[model samples]
Target: MRHNRTQHRSRRGTRSITAASATVLAVVAATAAVQSNAFGTEEEPTAVSQSPTEAQAQDCGAGTFQAQVAKAGDTWKARHGDTVLYTGDDMFAAMNAGLDSLTPNRTTKERMVVLGSGTISASERLKLPSYTVLDVCGTINATGAVATDTGPIFSRDTTDVEVQHAKITGAPMYGMFFRSVSNLTLGQIDMRLSGGLGIRIDNGSKATPATNTRIDDVYVSGASSHAVETAGLDGVTIGTVTARDVGEAGLLLNTTTHAEVGTVDAQNVGTGTGYAAFRMANRNGRIGDGYENNIHVNQVIARGGGRGIFCVSESGGAVIDRVDIADTGNNAILVENCYNVTIAAEGGTVSGAGGIRIAARDEFANTSDVTLENLTVTDSFIKESPCAENTVIKNVELVNTTKDVC
Candidate 1:
């Protein structure tokens, strides 16, 4: 069905501030700016009393609108306040109408687009650009050949974006693709299945890396590629991510800086010939010059996969605190060409052909300051260290190890 597309634009004119009033206005403006930057719209507002200044700041602009799709109408009827904006069969048309009605004043006022629970089957990518908050609680399903052109939910060049309680299923490419975004938060993301990565965050060659990203409680199953892949991002934190039957690594970080993961559980990842449950890599087998650094994983549990955790090509400053592996196809943890790293399987058990292997492929490149501590290995073995002098082991119990430790 064909429909008319609507566009929303908030074009409130700005007024110049006088020098005499600038002092008083600056104080009030600073307080409002703090509220706007604190994920203010993402959370529910407080019920306590607010001062007049706070109230005015919170209501930054007037003429805000909200639209909801009709439940049983063939045409997607969207209404703003009490007026009907449009009635059309196109889901994007209705969504765009709602977004266009709001004036872009960057205020803490009520600016939103509430998606209907009905499944939206789009032939092309639905773009949400420059939206302060995108609370998608509905399902967006793709209906086309799998390609790298776009995704079910693609957002770019946005800031302070929040994606909450959303599901993107059966996308040809990435379920959700975000690029050049900052101060982003994603929670309760459910990607039932996707042809490519479940979620991908990258620079998209925009030269502006995505930064300050937070992902919580994400689950992906039957992903043809990595469940979550991030590259060229700074300051990312992930929590409670689980992937099942992924073709490549469940989570892959390439050229990322200052990343922290709370917990990740991958099952049957690395379905392809070369991959891992969790893979971290930098460029050119070097660090400290436009390379990835400062990655920490608190807990990792992998079952039946290629090396549970693989660090390659100058991935350094990494600290993995706890790891549990059972019958993985390859080494449970493999570190090649990495430095200043520490992996501790404290209070955990590893059962596989190879427990932990640290090697430097290039004879000239040396792996230094690597430590493995408090690990209990059973029916497995760690490879002889490539840099015997720099590898340190503490409180480790080995059973049936084929190679001797340094």
Candidate 2:
């Protein structure tokens, strides 16, 4: 194969390219391969087939241009195998288009790996092969654009896919999306600097948990929004979700199904510089639905936001346990309109405003069966305390003063 190089080219974001037409980019470090199948006009060619011009190689046939990239807007059709090394800006668009053009069938064996300094913006969505494992070991920048949600890595009706080891910055929308997907895994993925959350799941209302999907060793910083937002999902796992220096919440686990978080360290997030962490010891929509969903926050270190643990406008049942909120601007744990939610903060220090604001709503009439077990509130003063009615508390202390149920 021959090395190819070029400059500025774009078209929405989900265009395709032919194998014979794809440009083999020059590389500092990355490996690539190229191959294809053969068909015929009269009788079919054997194992291999030659393009009208030739293959994507240095030495073409008798009279043909070598494996140079076709002109801009040119596409390769039905090309399967590829080894592409991308460099320079706009590689995001280039690579996305190339992968889309491949258009493999529903077979779960297609694979893609991109390695380079990829920087770009987009106005469209890109689709990858089903049962595809697209590995990106490089850098990507797509910040500053409103979420056209214009996707570069999207897999619908796909399963068992994995994306790992990449620096993805400035997502116009979701860093990665899985719709109707199963057993998907995003490993060692880093999304930081500008735009929205590092990752998000549609488990609460819109989409399912993309079942058996686990995001591990993911670190996000400087988010225009949450470092990671998981909503309306079930059976999802976040290994080490860490976010700091962000806007909005650090990690928003709202209206979810079955979720298990390892270590969540969110600081300096929300509005501008606040630490509104999570609330409700349990953040799940319950066995009440007969699904028996479960959620747990193993270890949390939150600083400087509104409420450190917040579960507002959530229904169903959940359990939250063992959270630590220190030096926060607002409440340490607050739950509003939560039903059958049990919160446990035994080994924690809540030294901030509104330590635990679990209410039935703005009034006492709209209450649920909520419980705060083994919680400790130190240096806490009411940021509008006197937590409404019909709430149960055991082995808990409300220190530094407030109005009680009197």
Candidate 3:
């Protein structure tokens, strides 16, 4: 169900952060750092010096690349083997020309590398074909308005595509958008945008739901919408979604199933609204007619935003292992009209937030098989209102707070 953004309630007054809250904050920061560094833990030996383009080419696996784009003076050049496909001022055009020059209907993957940093005044998106890898080793400054359905980079009806090391700055409709794609990988993307969404991956219809998608280490700031959003996706793995001052959820899963998420670290996201740091809606985690624990999250951290974790509109079957939430404007954790949900399976802490809530709307079935355990709540409360069935609340420590359960 779509939320009414116009009807926002007043936020609770800010509370002083205690020593306990500070400790939780530190833990959250450490968790984010650990996740960000997990893939780069191996030390690299010192090697011979190389030019920036040469080093970037090696990083992009350019030995297997069939096309290349490089900036020279005021112009960008696209080349394949000995053929110069394009030489122009538009970086986007040069990159696209490099892709278009590749041999079509190839059985194996074709790689392309953008060797250096440049700015593109693009009103259109750079599209990716199937069985392709586009490694952009340098920053891309995308400037100009785009159509509502397009973004800076997009792919549709594609299979086995990867984009690596993309650092973008713009207010496009989306930083990256992919639809009806299978076996897609987005690695180490950083977006600093002023408006629109950060990343969106979905199937245009349920008949062709995207499958086997992996997103590793994305950082988005100043976005007008969710940092990462997925709809109609199956078998997806998300490493981390880090958000700062985003207008909506840090990571939102809608009608998606078979998901594994590492961490969602958000700060000042969706203030004064019902959007959350992590949200599941539109029957997420559903398998067949029953709900399964298909959506698994390792950790979630939120500070000074709206909700911390939200499961609404018959979405559930998730196990959120840990959380560190503080000073949220709306409910710290809310499970509404959901099923088979468990929060803080390991342990967690919440402070100075609206606390945890379990509610149900009359239109849907009551939330069932829900558990909230192993949590320490400080300066907040936990309540199960109009209590549902088989709801479990155990091993909870309340400091300056109370629990009203039925």
Q: For this target, which candidate reaches the highest lDDT against the unseen true structure? A: 3
Per-residue CA lDDT of candidate 3, range 1-406, in tens?
3211111111210121122233333433443443343223212212435432223223333345678887767788889888999998888889999999977977567778776677765468888898888877566777776686687788998898878557778787888999999988776688888888999999987575788787767899998999999999977777778999999999999999777777899999999889999999998877666675667788999998899999998887688989999999999999999888889999999988488999999998888888888999999999898788788899989999988889
lDDT of 1 by residue, 214-245 (tens): 77657888888889988878767787679898
Ranking by TM-score: 3, 1, 2
Q: Compute the lDDT for candidate 2.
A: 0.51
What TM-score against the true fold does each predicted structure earn?
0.77, 0.68, 0.85
Cα lDDT listed for each candidate: 0.63, 0.51, 0.78
Regions more than 4 Å wrong, model 2: 1-90, 97-103, 122-125, 143-147, 203-210, 272-275, 279-293, 362-365, 382-390, 397-403
lDDT of 1 at 332: 85
Give the Cα error of residue 16 in candidate 1, in Å: 37
- Return model 1's CA RMSD, one decimal: 12.8
Which residue runs does candidate 1 get wrong by more than 4 Å? 1-70, 73-75, 105-123, 206-208, 283-293
> After TM-score superposition, what is the CA distance of residue 328 in candidate 2 from its true location, in Å?
2.1
